[model samples]
Target: MLSWRRSTSATAPGSSLAYGCADFLGGPGARKAHVLRTVMVAAPAGLAVELLLWPVLGASFSGAPLGWGAASGAASAAAFALLHRTLAIGPMNVLSPVTALVSAALPVGVALLHGEHLGAAGLVGLPLALVAVVQVGAGHGAGVARPSRTALLLAFGAGTAIALQLIFLHQAPSDSGVAPLITGRAVSSAVTLAAAGQMHRRLGAERPAYAMSAAASVLDSLANLLFLLAARNGDLTVVAVITALYPAGAVLLARGVLAERVHRGRLIGLGTAAVAVSLLALT
Candidate 1:
């Protein structure tokens, strides 16, 4: 009986040790799944809220070509899914700022192509924004630790997707009364759901994960609706730049909830971005 007890105790520890290693290796994949699932839940909820508010907000449905919006929504969903995946296993400090810069710059370039000239301040701000991206990409400390190539690539893709989303949203007809947004959200949700399914894993097993996912979905939908409205009435450059400041919220949340350390380089990069946004706004 004593020998059996000893053998059982030894087996338990070995099993636990194996479990720990498996958990660590699988962490990234699990996190990716969680993020995608959150998006799936959040997007549909957001769409519902937008639909409910449409009539109250006096939005009218104009017959607009929805191809661009649908395409943009699919792209955005893919980008966001990738972004969350990167953030799960990569450096948030690096990804957030780089993504923000790309998101802001692309719309500005589009605006310029459309004959929207920048003022002196905007001209100056553009360079500063680029510099900020570089600084953030260079790492957030004295040693200048850069993110993995995969992470950087993911960040770039995310930004590009955001820019496309904003640009396409602007193309929506003025009379479309939130229909484009609804269409876009639907597409995004569908894409996200497909991605989650492709993972072949269970989603939101934890209560907290479900709650956070729901909250994120509501906020994301609200943000998308606002961006559509803003882009419809304003310059795409101006609106995109304003919206790109979203990373600031994420940064703060990371600091508060995760207690992540913000090194000097990150601070400098973030500051530069703030100044650039101010100048862009002034221009």
Candidate 2:
């Protein structure tokens, strides 16, 4: 919970935590079931959260917001399908950094084109942010098969789609409220359910991750909500960079909950991320 004026200071970290927790659960859930089937749980759960938030936030029917929401839904659907597919089949060491780096870069590029500058502290923080993401991503899931041409394309596409989802949500008018989120989640859910229905036989045979998926979906939706607020209240470049630090959170969660060792690179990344955030916030 953050006031609109203070949200920029708080929401980015809040969003990062939500995203981290979501990925933590979503990763294991995907391993248990088909990733798309896990999305079946996420779709409805996320949609329900948006619907609940809609009334509290207030919304209006507007063509621009609605169109942007639908576009975001499509991008989100593509990202969820592609990124996980790539990770499932390709080398995590190479492709994960590709996705993470591209996603962080695209939003900052857009923000620059829109004349939003990160200023002096941000200049230093920006490169650190990029380095942090690389370290965070590269430290995990090592030594799978090298990425194929198809996997490379999918990783890049997933990154672009993720960036587009954030940009589209950022484009929604402030007065439009959470309607865009509701519309986007509803569209994505319907698409995911249709895909899951087709794989019902396969999904049925696999272990279900109902509770885990639901919790992840809820947290992911909340993260998006917090991100939208932060973007609205602050420079897009700043918020996007901070939000991309989510992998650091995931790594930390893994250390605490799963008793996994935090590799040196990820530990450095997490520490770097903390310093970058402090500098970005202060100046």
Which predicted model would earn the best TM-score? Answer: 2
Q: Taking the tens digit of each residue's C-alpha lDDT, what string does model 2 give over 1-283?
A: 2234445868887888899889998888767666777776778888888888876777766998898888888888888888878877778788887888888899999999999876799899988888888888875555455778898898898889898998898898876778778888877888888888887877656764788889999999999999988888888888888888888778888999999998777888888888888877764
lDDT tens readout by residue for model 1, 20-105 = 23222223323544555555556667688767766655444444536766876877786776667677656765676677688778
Q: Cα lDDT of all candidates, in order? A: 0.63, 0.83
- Candidate 1: residue pairs that collide: 42-217, 62-175, 62-176
Quote the RMSD, in angstroms, for model 2. Answer: 2.0
Q: What is the lDDT of residue 147 in candidate 1?
A: 79
**Stretches of candidate 1 exceeding 4 Å from the true structure:** 1-33, 58-65, 88-92, 130-139, 142-150, 198-208, 253-261
Clashes of 1: 3
**Model 2 TM-score, all chains together:** 0.94
TM-score for all models, in order of appearance: 0.73, 0.94
Off by over 4 Å in 2: 1-4, 140-145, 201-204
